[model samples]
Each structure stands twice: as structure tokens, then as C-alpha cells.
Target: MLATPRPRSTFSNAQIAAYFYSPCRNQYDEPVPEYFRCRCWKIRKQTSRNGFTNLMQHVRSEHPTFQEEMLAATTAQTSSVAH
Candidate 1:
């Protein structure tokens, strides 16, 4: 079987920083890599959680423009693969 290439991040660092981060810091004063928090305006800033679920939900609910961007990108990839 052929190995599929790994995908890169679709959004830029600035775009990513606008919505999410891992707030907890270690002894070295660096953010922990495993945990993440959603920083959407519509919802209260919550406890930093794990995974993309919270971030995606924030995008879908609080940020329509971004959600559309994500859908468009995914749709393009899907159509390309189907051809």
C-alpha cells in the first residue's frame, strides 16, 4: 500500500491564535501541548479542554464566516478526490 502524505494546517498561526490556545503552563513557563481552549465571543471562556471538538463547535456556532471557510476547503478536497 502507498503511504499517504501527512496534511498540513489549513489556517495560519494568526488565524489559529484568534480562537484557541493551551493556557496551562509547565515549570518551564510554556503552554502544554495536549490541551486546548476555545476563545469564542459567543461563549464564555471555558476551561481548556482536549481535541478539536470544542474549537470546531465554536467555529460552527459562533463564527459562520470561518465555518464556511472550513466547509469550502473540505468540499474542494472531497470533490478533487472523487474525480
Candidate 2:
């Protein structure tokens, strides 16, 4: 039997890292970080968390503008590649 294919991520690691800074790093960029800084909170410190589910939920709720921009960029890149 054929193995099931995993769905590709809508957000790339570089894009995600640029928008949300990750704490953990290594020799190479292949390994994803364990935590990401939140863009919200106008205080002395920012929030951080592990896993994409939390990060995605935070983006969907707190950063609609960023989300829209990412979507637009992704769409443009895909269209350009198709042509």
C-alpha cells in the first residue's frame, strides 16, 4: 500500500521566523525552534511558546494584517511560479 502524503505547510520556516522570532538555533536552519516570540503585549517582555498550533492561533487572532500579507505573498509566489 502507498503511504499517505503529508500536507505541505502554508508558512515556510524563514517566513515564520521573520515574522515571529525563534529562540532556539543550531548550526543549520533545518531544525525548527522550540519557541516563538509573540508580536502582541506592549509591556516590558513578550510572550513565547512552543508548537505551530499556538503560533497559528495567535496569528489568526492577534495579527490579521500580517496573516493577510503572508497570504497575499504566498498567492503571488504561486501564481508567478505557475506562469
* lDDT tens readout by residue for model 1, 42-70: 33233346335555556545665653454
Instruction: List residue ranges in candidate 2 displaced over 4 A.
Output: 1-14, 24-33, 41-50, 71-83
Stretches > 4 Å off in candidate 1: 1-28, 37-50, 67-83
Worst 10-residue lDDT window, candidate 2 = 41-50
Candidate 1 structure lDDT: 0.48
| Residue pairs in candidate 1 whose N, alpha carbon or C atoms collide under 3 angstroms | none
Q: In angstroms, how far off is 4's CA in candidate 1?
A: 32
lDDT of 2 by residue, 1-83 (tens): 99988456466534553554445435785544454455463111223444355566565556656545656665454333421
